[model samples]
Target: MKSTLNSTSESATAAIFLSAVLFCFAPVCSGEESSNKRTGEDIYKQFCSSCHVAGGNTAKPSKPIAGSKVLKSIATFQEYLENPPGHMPYYKTVVNDKSMVRKLYEYCKKLKQTQGA
Candidate 1:
Protein backbone atom coordinates (compact mmCIF):
# COMPACT_ATOMS: atom_id res chain seq x y z
CA MET A 1 0.00 0.00 0.00
CA LYS A 2 2.78 2.47 0.83
CA SER A 3 4.62 1.66 -2.40
CA THR A 4 1.50 2.24 -4.41
CA LEU A 5 0.97 5.65 -2.78
CA ASN A 6 4.57 6.68 -3.48
CA SER A 7 4.29 5.71 -7.14
CA THR A 8 1.06 7.67 -7.49
CA SER A 9 2.63 10.69 -5.85
CA GLU A 10 5.65 10.50 -8.15
CA SER A 11 3.41 10.23 -11.19
CA ALA A 12 1.40 13.26 -10.14
CA THR A 13 4.55 15.28 -9.52
CA ALA A 14 5.95 14.42 -12.97
CA ALA A 15 2.71 15.35 -14.65
CA ILE A 16 2.55 18.68 -12.84
CA PHE A 17 6.14 19.51 -13.73
CA LEU A 18 5.54 18.71 -17.40
CA SER A 19 2.42 20.88 -17.45
CA ALA A 20 4.28 23.79 -15.88
CA VAL A 21 7.09 23.55 -18.37
CA LEU A 22 4.65 23.58 -21.30
CA PHE A 23 2.75 26.48 -19.81
CA CYS A 24 5.89 28.56 -19.54
CA PHE A 25 6.73 28.04 -23.21
CA ALA A 26 3.21 28.40 -24.57
CA PRO A 27 3.27 32.20 -24.76
CA VAL A 28 6.61 32.34 -26.50
CA CYS A 29 5.51 29.82 -29.10
CA SER A 30 2.23 31.60 -29.71
CA GLY A 31 3.93 34.96 -30.05
CA GLU A 32 6.28 33.65 -32.69
CA GLU A 33 3.41 32.12 -34.60
CA SER A 34 1.48 35.37 -34.53
CA SER A 35 4.46 37.34 -35.76
CA ASN A 36 4.99 34.91 -38.59
CA LYS A 37 1.35 35.29 -39.61
CA ARG A 38 1.79 39.03 -40.21
CA THR A 39 1.47 40.10 -43.83
CA GLY A 40 4.19 41.66 -45.96
CA GLU A 41 2.61 45.08 -45.68
CA ASP A 42 2.54 44.80 -41.91
CA ILE A 43 6.27 44.08 -41.79
CA TYR A 44 7.09 46.88 -44.21
CA LYS A 45 4.99 49.41 -42.37
CA GLN A 46 6.49 48.45 -39.06
CA PHE A 47 10.15 48.29 -40.07
CA CYS A 48 10.65 50.08 -43.41
CA SER A 49 8.09 52.87 -43.53
CA SER A 50 10.24 55.37 -41.61
CA CYS A 51 13.17 55.07 -43.96
CA HIS A 52 11.33 54.24 -47.17
CA VAL A 53 8.19 56.30 -47.13
CA ALA A 54 5.60 55.22 -49.68
CA GLY A 55 8.29 53.08 -51.33
CA GLY A 56 10.47 56.15 -51.83
CA ASN A 57 13.79 56.71 -50.15
CA THR A 58 13.56 59.92 -48.17
CA ALA A 59 17.31 60.10 -47.54
CA LYS A 60 18.31 59.34 -51.14
CA PRO A 61 15.74 60.55 -53.63
CA SER A 62 17.72 59.17 -56.53
CA LYS A 63 17.68 55.65 -55.17
CA PRO A 64 14.00 55.26 -54.47
CA ILE A 65 12.67 51.78 -53.77
CA ALA A 66 10.07 52.19 -56.49
CA GLY A 67 11.16 50.41 -59.66
CA SER A 68 14.55 49.63 -58.19
CA LYS A 69 16.49 46.83 -59.83
CA VAL A 70 17.21 45.34 -56.44
CA LEU A 71 13.62 44.16 -56.15
CA LYS A 72 13.92 42.38 -59.45
CA SER A 73 14.68 39.06 -57.70
CA ILE A 74 14.53 37.54 -54.25
CA ALA A 75 18.25 36.70 -54.29
CA THR A 76 19.26 40.28 -55.01
CA PHE A 77 16.85 41.70 -52.50
CA GLN A 78 18.05 39.34 -49.77
CA GLU A 79 21.66 40.17 -50.52
CA TYR A 80 21.02 43.92 -50.41
CA LEU A 81 19.19 43.67 -47.11
CA GLU A 82 21.93 41.53 -45.64
CA ASN A 83 24.67 43.89 -46.83
CA PRO A 84 23.15 47.30 -47.43
CA PRO A 85 25.19 50.26 -48.65
CA GLY A 86 25.27 54.00 -48.14
CA HIS A 87 22.86 55.23 -45.47
CA MET A 88 20.98 51.95 -45.34
CA PRO A 89 21.60 49.85 -42.25
CA TYR A 90 22.25 46.12 -42.29
CA TYR A 91 18.99 44.13 -42.03
CA LYS A 92 20.48 40.71 -41.65
CA THR A 93 19.02 40.32 -38.19
CA VAL A 94 15.66 41.83 -39.08
CA VAL A 95 15.28 39.55 -42.08
CA ASN A 96 17.07 36.61 -40.56
CA ASP A 97 14.28 34.24 -41.60
CA LYS A 98 13.78 33.47 -45.27
CA SER A 99 10.00 33.81 -45.01
CA MET A 100 10.36 37.31 -43.52
CA VAL A 101 12.74 38.37 -46.29
CA ARG A 102 10.30 37.05 -48.88
CA LYS A 103 7.40 38.88 -47.27
CA LEU A 104 9.29 42.19 -47.30
CA TYR A 105 10.36 41.63 -50.89
CA GLU A 106 6.81 40.98 -52.02
CA TYR A 107 5.55 44.08 -50.24
CA CYS A 108 8.23 46.21 -51.90
CA LYS A 109 7.36 44.76 -55.29
CA LYS A 110 3.72 45.59 -54.73
CA LEU A 111 4.68 49.12 -53.83
CA LYS A 112 6.64 49.40 -57.04
CA GLN A 113 3.69 48.26 -59.08
CA THR A 114 1.32 50.65 -57.34
CA GLN A 115 3.70 53.54 -57.87
CA GLY A 116 3.66 52.79 -61.62
CA ALA A 117 7.32 51.88 -61.56
Candidate 2:
Protein backbone atom coordinates (compact mmCIF):
# COMPACT_ATOMS: atom_id res chain seq x y z
CA MET A 1 0.00 0.00 0.00
CA LYS A 2 2.87 2.42 0.82
CA SER A 3 4.55 1.67 -2.53
CA THR A 4 1.29 2.28 -4.36
CA LEU A 5 0.84 5.65 -2.64
CA ASN A 6 4.40 6.73 -3.45
CA SER A 7 3.96 5.89 -7.10
CA THR A 8 0.75 7.87 -7.30
CA SER A 9 2.37 10.82 -5.59
CA GLU A 10 5.29 10.71 -8.01
CA SER A 11 2.90 10.65 -10.93
CA ALA A 12 1.03 13.62 -9.57
CA THR A 13 4.24 15.58 -9.12
CA ALA A 14 5.33 14.72 -12.65
CA ALA A 15 2.03 15.93 -14.03
CA ILE A 16 2.35 19.23 -12.18
CA PHE A 17 5.90 19.69 -13.36
CA LEU A 18 4.91 19.03 -16.94
CA SER A 19 2.03 21.47 -16.69
CA ALA A 20 4.34 24.19 -15.40
CA VAL A 21 6.82 23.65 -18.15
CA LEU A 22 4.11 23.87 -20.80
CA PHE A 23 2.66 26.97 -19.20
CA CYS A 24 6.01 28.72 -19.03
CA PHE A 25 6.76 28.12 -22.65
CA ALA A 26 3.25 28.90 -23.88
CA PRO A 27 3.59 32.69 -24.07
CA VAL A 28 6.97 32.53 -25.74
CA CYS A 29 5.77 30.06 -28.35
CA SER A 30 2.56 31.97 -29.06
CA GLY A 31 4.31 35.30 -29.55
CA GLU A 32 6.81 33.87 -32.02
CA GLU A 33 4.28 31.87 -34.00
CA SER A 34 3.22 34.73 -36.24
CA SER A 35 6.30 36.90 -36.80
CA ASN A 36 9.94 37.05 -37.92
CA LYS A 37 10.86 40.70 -37.48
CA ARG A 38 14.22 41.33 -35.78
CA THR A 39 14.77 43.95 -33.12
CA GLY A 40 17.04 46.92 -33.95
CA GLU A 41 20.05 45.63 -31.97
CA ASP A 42 19.78 42.31 -33.75
CA ILE A 43 20.00 44.23 -37.01
CA TYR A 44 23.02 46.05 -35.66
CA LYS A 45 24.66 42.85 -34.47
CA GLN A 46 23.86 40.70 -37.48
CA PHE A 47 24.33 43.33 -40.20
CA CYS A 48 25.74 46.56 -38.90
CA SER A 49 28.23 45.47 -36.24
CA SER A 50 31.06 44.37 -38.55
CA CYS A 51 31.30 47.72 -40.28
CA HIS A 52 30.17 49.78 -37.33
CA VAL A 53 32.68 48.06 -35.06
CA ALA A 54 35.52 49.24 -37.26
CA GLY A 55 33.98 52.71 -37.22
CA GLY A 56 34.33 53.30 -33.46
CA ASN A 57 33.02 52.65 -29.94
CA THR A 58 29.90 54.51 -30.88
CA ALA A 59 27.29 52.47 -32.64
CA LYS A 60 27.28 55.11 -35.37
CA PRO A 61 28.01 53.83 -38.84
CA SER A 62 30.95 54.86 -40.98
CA LYS A 63 28.68 56.43 -43.60
CA PRO A 64 26.06 57.25 -40.98
CA ILE A 65 23.75 54.54 -42.27
CA ALA A 66 21.92 54.08 -38.97
CA GLY A 67 20.40 57.53 -39.05
CA SER A 68 20.61 57.81 -42.78
CA LYS A 69 17.67 58.93 -44.85
CA VAL A 70 16.90 55.37 -45.91
CA LEU A 71 16.86 53.79 -42.45
CA LYS A 72 14.87 56.63 -40.96
CA SER A 73 11.82 56.72 -43.20
CA ILE A 74 10.89 53.09 -42.71
CA ALA A 75 8.62 52.28 -39.76
CA THR A 76 10.43 48.96 -39.35
CA PHE A 77 14.12 48.15 -39.56
CA GLN A 78 13.12 44.71 -40.83
CA GLU A 79 11.79 46.21 -44.02
CA TYR A 80 15.09 47.91 -44.65
CA LEU A 81 17.03 44.77 -43.80
CA GLU A 82 14.91 42.62 -46.08
CA ASN A 83 16.44 44.38 -49.06
CA PRO A 84 19.79 45.84 -48.22
CA PRO A 85 22.29 46.62 -51.02
CA GLY A 86 23.11 43.91 -53.55
CA HIS A 87 26.07 42.81 -51.44
CA MET A 88 23.83 41.94 -48.53
CA PRO A 89 22.12 38.58 -48.88
CA TYR A 90 18.38 38.97 -48.35
CA TYR A 91 17.63 37.66 -44.84
CA LYS A 92 14.17 36.66 -46.03
CA THR A 93 15.41 33.06 -45.73
CA VAL A 94 17.81 33.15 -42.74
CA VAL A 95 15.26 35.28 -40.97
CA ASN A 96 12.60 32.65 -41.49
CA ASP A 97 12.77 31.84 -37.77
CA LYS A 98 9.66 33.39 -36.26
CA SER A 99 9.84 36.74 -34.43
CA MET A 100 13.59 37.00 -35.02
CA VAL A 101 13.20 40.23 -36.94
CA ARG A 102 10.76 41.73 -34.48
CA LYS A 103 13.02 41.00 -31.55
CA LEU A 104 15.96 42.38 -33.49
CA TYR A 105 14.13 45.70 -33.91
CA GLU A 106 13.53 45.90 -30.19
CA TYR A 107 17.17 45.11 -29.53
CA CYS A 108 18.30 47.86 -31.93
CA LYS A 109 16.20 50.49 -30.18
CA LYS A 110 17.79 49.36 -26.92
CA LEU A 111 21.43 49.79 -28.02
CA LYS A 112 20.80 53.52 -28.08
CA GLN A 113 20.11 53.56 -24.35
CA THR A 114 21.80 50.38 -23.06
CA GLN A 115 25.33 49.15 -23.53
CA GLY A 116 24.32 45.53 -23.02
CA ALA A 117 22.82 45.52 -26.51
Who wins the lDDT comparison? 1
TM-score for each model:
0.68, 0.45
Model 1 whole-model lDDT (C-alpha atoms): 0.82
Which candidate should be chosen as best, given TM-score against the real structure?
A: 1
Candidate 1 lDDT over 27-96, as tens digits, reads 5555564557779888888788887889988777778887899998999999898889999877654568
The lDDT for every candidate, in the order shown, is 0.82, 0.53
- lDDT score of residue 29 within candidate 1: 59
**Shift of residue 48 alpha carbon in model 1, Å:** 0.9
In angstroms, give how far residue 110 of model 1 lies from its true place.
0.5
